[model samples]
Target: MEIRPMRSWIHHRRGEVLRQGGVGRSAMPGVYEDMLTRHGFEGRDAYLYRRHESTAWKRAEGAGIHLDLDGRLLEPTDLTDAGGNPLRLFYNPDGAVSVSRRSANMTYSARNADGDELYFVHKGTGTFYTEFGPIPYEPGDYVLLPKGVTYRIRPTGPDNYFMIIETTEELGFADIGPHGRRAPFDPGLLYVPSPELDDLGDGRNQDGEWPVRVKYQGGFTTAYYDFDPIDAIGWSGDLFPFKLNIRDFRPITSDRIHIMPSGHAVFATSTVVVGNYLPRPLESAPDAEPFPPIHRNMDYDEFLFTHAGTALGVPMPPASFALTPRGLHHGLPAKVEEELRKGIKPGTVADFEFIFVDWAHSLVATPEALAQKRAGDQLREGVAAQ
Candidate 1:
């Protein structure tokens, strides 16, 4: 890890106390609060009190990309052909995010030689037939398949949607800190399959080649076998594929302050951090914002898939998702900010829910995503409606 410089200083303001006489407070009357933070809101921060919206801009022409995509419209190749795989959405050296709309059972098994894979079930029920065993999946579940582990997914239903984050690094559970794992989720809630050999059969076409496709460095290598290769009847190991549903997550909340996103991290690797933006009690402090702080995260890029609910006045359709590149100021949509500007009562609830993944480095979107990109701003969702 690169050493970040540390220094000692006192925070002094140049402007008058618009209202709360403090830093990082959200919209109050005509004033706006914008924050610049390091370490994903866990480190040093500078809150800017402005007379205007922090997310406002005259125009963003090039690299100032803030993307909002409608995943409900994406047509992944896997939806039609069994030989097809997830359609690449965004990628960088560390990882890639893809979407799969597969409606059929796989004709062959596959393995990722590059890294571990995470499949966030946006919709549908299915079973992951892996070498370890079979793990059934449903909407709102996160299925993790370790690198080099052979697996294939078979949908139990016809309509299915999945948001997948496949990375080139090892994946593990996030530390629950002093609260222990029971706080966010109980490890016991994880559905880990043991190696069991039952109903295991040859490929759909038993008389044909049963191919084991291995994906490495964005290329596939097929090894055909006359007989099925998933022959493990018993195995003993801590390493295996598992599933965790979002409904079981208990996100920490505070009525006094808006907790940072990192506080919601359920999974992390050296290169990525995955979190659930579940509904929780909003801040009730008389002087604080009820929503997340308006922030320009200096380090990581954020990717969010809205499973349900309207967020920041943005009515989320099925499979709604957004991307806020690192350094881009983001938070509530402008329309919601305006509502906050008016005033909010005590004990408000944050009803919005989504699954967010943060990459330590930047992500490059695929051509498919670029073709239908929507120009977004903090207010665009609301502004466009007008």
Candidate 2:
């Protein structure tokens, strides 16, 4: 299947709203208070109000909001009414749902879909159910669902948060040459619940039908389907739900020198590549120093979401993201490299996991994203000057 750069449809609309001076009425009763008094929203401020609103809005529109499926610019109408909901966003036209987990106590249903889905769990811990069984997932876990699978999420220990990328396209691993189907990364690593776990109280199947609710126009729309979302039955095929634990991705390395950035690839789609900082031995050869210059590869576009630890000597205060588009000369800044040369361990199992969703098709940054880029540069300068 052809891979395309995915964009967040919500961010584009939110940028429009911000450009248009916010949505709804700022003075109108806040969605929090209104939902609490009217819709029985009793969650904490963080859940009902704080961060949740923006998270929900972004998810509804799309995370990594790009243009559109046809590569056209996304407009406001492209976004569904994700307002008032605590944890989900529904897409227009296709009815695909993007669920964002903002709190640890959040529990929601994973209903059946007419199309396939890709879920990236960014934070928190939880138990996810498929028609087969329940699989426990933690932060940085990615899950893929085939079309028509029914599932639900239960945040067992703590409130967890994650982002789901729903699409009609079937997502699979990039084809490896000669190896054919059995690639280095086993498809089974994606984790389906065992039969023992499958017996965990009959999952979310309600009499062969699953209850799904959608938001359309300005109200709630509920629909019941006649088949269980997970009715894949006994079909063994390449296209199926899989999960890859980001932590389990073993990075290839060189014993005497740092490998090239492409060596850091954990996964790649047709147009996108996910890279990690895997552990490598320090290159201390004659005339070779411990620090390696940031090598720029122009073959693909790269966006790094800093999942953990400091990377390239840049002090990432956790959960912060950095983007290095194709042709952008990004590497360890000079001073940080100096520190590494002074006997710092050259590698650690890349504590940092970032998604590099490149597109075989070229992409253009939205005007709003461009403005954010300018602001980011200004902030970087301010920090340096400080």
Candidate 3:
């Protein structure tokens, strides 16, 4: 049997650094500041100041930061598939992120037998007609649906956008921790719809022999219903779909240092945890760097949807998405890094809002997802400047 070495959490530092923590401290000249940490900035860590620094390494796999494929450019199945489904973009064993461009009501009620589904309303005002009740959703609202629940979205506006996340396990609100249950967003603020008692809808989904689309094990099975599926007179249970809007989210901030991304965790399944990166103040200490340090997410893959606003004045277009694998260094765009190196301006606030998933499994961007890169570039090739 092989034996493992004992590990210690003691602090050890050498070469050009006179101290341990980099907070309010600057490294010596000609030193490349890079940190290697375990458990996403937690656990034992090391700050290495190397003599050489370069990103000129060549060739293959997750090559560049892809911010070109706008979410609106891709065509979802709701526009093409006869049954009306979203377009699968990035997926893994644990979860998947798909984009939906829906402007009309779904003809068939859909049920996911595979996993719990959640939709981030990027752009739309719609009512999610579920078996329980009708939950009206707006932009920045997250519509949470339990697995095997019957539901269909009916948009009341044009250019409706949705980014769907489906996971194998049920997702619950992340722990409130030291702040308690009411700090981030009170459980009371969650709008759990009551079943429509008097009237579900006037002649809606009344098409003869209405179909219920059931997605199971990568294939779909349709079950025909003799009447409308939203015929629930009453519902009494703890397990039901609900909505949590971004407006209710209270962020954790610190002017001393740029807090870790985990501080913004909102929802989590057994295998994945979702983080909401909302607009907030940046670090303000005189000697402290105001941006995330150059580090690798060693344990989980990072996938993000840039929803809106300027990311610290860095021009990441709204609705653009990007994926940084587990081992690759996180991208610090040139313009943003320059401001970081100089330390952020005092009392500066970043208005950028994004939805990111720190999934435990390595993700694979689907072929149709990859094809969007080519299609996007071609579409933008001859467009006139605004």
Candidate 4:
């Protein structure tokens, strides 16, 4: 809750501050002075830390992942129980990926890594057992596992599916200027069973061990260590798993023309922004454009994944994914706009269930994810076959 003053300056031909207004000549110097005067040494340190954190959050919030259309040879590992289907992994350049399947239960052990991981349950129900406690997750629930936090997953049903986004940097909430206080995807919105006690069942009756498996990369080879993955007993720290339901995300829109892209950000990390296109009324303008504008954004690489609706005029059958890299302009197809102009409510609650992952760093899609996109086409073909 520390507030910094604004410093305005007028620059001369030599790039020197000719005139200073408001507070000071530079924003940084004003901020530093404010920190030292208001907060003592300890407070100053906390202020600096918070400042850095805010910057990091902004960077991550503006970044995104663009879907890879080119098919490649990415790896898929099986971590499910006997006869259980395997969870597919789609790796991105920043060490982020998504896991999805019809009926698969997978477990990942806590380990030190160069990145942070996020789990979004698109469909299905399951429990995430962590050092803090067991958290029940379902479709639209987003969970984040900070780096080095130990945890595992236990499926409660047959069709347990998830979308995992792993990042090499810590993920956080986006900073919604001035009046914005709470995190875009506040942890409170994420439902953790009532009573906050382990009364669901025997905490030890789970099929797999408390600690499950660990995967790490070495020189020219990948190593897997198999042992009890849960060893975090009687330990406490700020790092832990937190879940937020996408449905609980409060969106900000406009009654006029257009809402800034930042308005669409639901959650963010160090280098990414998770945006939601919730169902809401568009700006009422008699001559308003029928579709959202295709504006060029430099801050993020946009990856739009269809969770339950058609996107950009494309009927994104379930599991369909698309990407638009930084500086790329994308919008609904022209024909879609024509349909909307004809007074058709083309947008629906189910049509806006897509998940957008924006990354600040350059991202390369894994072969497996590309294959999934290709498989989607095959699915369409199969539908045609019938």
Query: Which number leads on lDDT?
Result: 1
TM-score of 1: 0.89
Identify the runs in model 4 with alpha carbons over 4 angstroms from their true place: 1-76, 79-93, 102-112, 179-187, 190-212, 217-237, 310-315, 327-329, 344-351, 374-386
In candidate 4, what are the lDDT values of residues 143-213, reduced to their tens digit? Answer: 88777655556667766556677766567765545445553445455543222334333223145333333
Tell me the spans in candidate 3 whose CA falls farther than 4 Å from its real position.
1-9, 18-22, 54-68, 80-82, 197-207, 333-335, 340-343, 374-386
Candidates' C-alpha lDDT: 0.75, 0.40, 0.70, 0.48
Ten-residue stretch with the least lDDT total in model 1: 377-386
lDDT tens digits, residue span 1-386, model 3: 01112345677666566354546435455555556665554446677666654222343354433223566578887865435689899887777889988767777888999898999998989788888988999999999999988987878865788899998888887662578768777889999988874443422344555788899887899888777877897889799999999989988887776677767888887568787888787777766666654566676667778778765565656776666666644445334465545545777777878888877787888877776553333111211000
In terms of TM-score, how similar is model 4 to the real structure? 0.64
After aligning candidate 2 to the native by TM-score, how far in Å is the CA of 3 from where it should be?
Answer: 11
Which of the two, 3 or 4, has more TM-score?
3
Off by over 4 Å in 2: 1-99, 102-116, 163-169, 175-190, 194-210, 213-222, 225-238, 279-299, 312-315, 345-351, 362-386
The ten-residue window of minimal lDDT in model 4 covers 33-42
TM-score top scorer: 1
lDDT of 1 by residue, 35-120 (tens): 78776655577777777776676666676578877787788888998767889889989888999998888878889998889999
Q: Clashes in model 1: which pairs?
A: none
Steric clash count of candidate 3: 0
Indicate whether candidate 1 or candidate 2 has the larger lDDT: 1
